[model samples]
Target: MAEEKDAAEALVTDLQKKITDAFDVFDHESNKTVDVREIGTIIRSLGCCPTEGELHEMLAEMEEEEPTGYIRFDKFLPTMTKVLLERRYRPISDDIILRAFEVLDENKKGYLTRDELVKYMTEEGEPFTQEEMEEMISAAVDPDKNIVPYKDYAAMMVIDD
Candidate 1:
């Protein structure tokens, strides 16, 4: 008889693994804690570049203690896992996807302009160069040169892959 793993336990395990991997990749010297600057680089390595202020704020929230500025293995693990689990559990219904598209297409023209992308992603301080935004929209737009539909957006998030 195998015992079922509780949600908290599972989340803790997953978060710890991710934190360990991040530490290994970012900490070339294998120091337990990465310097504040390196934390920004690590977050960028995960694809979204965080501004300095954003990095500081995020780290401040993540760190429970002040001394070493460390996200202790125990403390870091559970938080990350909870976030991932919530994301995984979120029901991306068709209505939700349609609403997201509508939100993104602020002009209601059914297509996302480069300006809109910049404006949207900028809330996170992730400024995309005009060229980058253009490329992203090019890839995201559907055939017939029409804007990406809700179905397409939802398909991008398929968890079972």
Candidate 2:
């Protein structure tokens, strides 16, 4: 009861500290504010993945608060807390990620060669852009085998909270 409340409050404090520290790095001039234009990077640095449209929407709220177009720490903190609590950007479950890879593996090979994944990611369904494919492959492929061992990759991809 009381302990749970204290734990939740402590978590919020930690999140606020992290966001403030990241915001300071980009603040460069120590203005205690950041350009609204860089809000996406700020959010990403804090491990939040809001889409472009979502960023636009969030920035709209900041626009109302700071007519000067820079976001202060006070304005940034509550907005970030709301976004985190909503959990809209939570990582996809590992089970679902593994299932997706299994579908691509086709022959139950338990892995995807680099070339095969490139083709599937770039040509199938809502395709990955060239940059997205390159990034995923670089991080996910086995250098020796030249393949993506997706079972292991899923563990890397799913960042729990």
Number of the predicted model whose lDDT against the real structure is largest: 2
Q: Write down the TM-score of every candidate.
A: 0.47, 0.72
Assess candidate 2 and give its lDDT: 0.82
Local accuracy of candidate 2 as per-residue lDDT tens digits, 1-161:
99999999998888878878888887967978888767878887777766667778888876654378688777888888877766555557889999999998889999999999898887877666677788899999999999999999988987665
Instruction: For candidate 1, report its TM-score.
Output: 0.47
Worst 10 residues of 2 by lDDT: 83-92
Where model 2 places Cα greater than 4 Å from the true spot, the runs are: 1-9, 33-38, 51-53, 63-74, 124-130
- List candidate 1 stretches off by more than 4 Å: 5-15, 37-58, 64-75, 78-95, 103-109, 119-154, 157-161
lDDT (Cα, tens digit) per residue for candidate 1, span 98-151? 677687766787556444555675664457666666766676656475555545
**Per-residue lDDT of 65 in model 1:** 66
Query: Model 2 RMSD to the real structure?
Result: 3.4
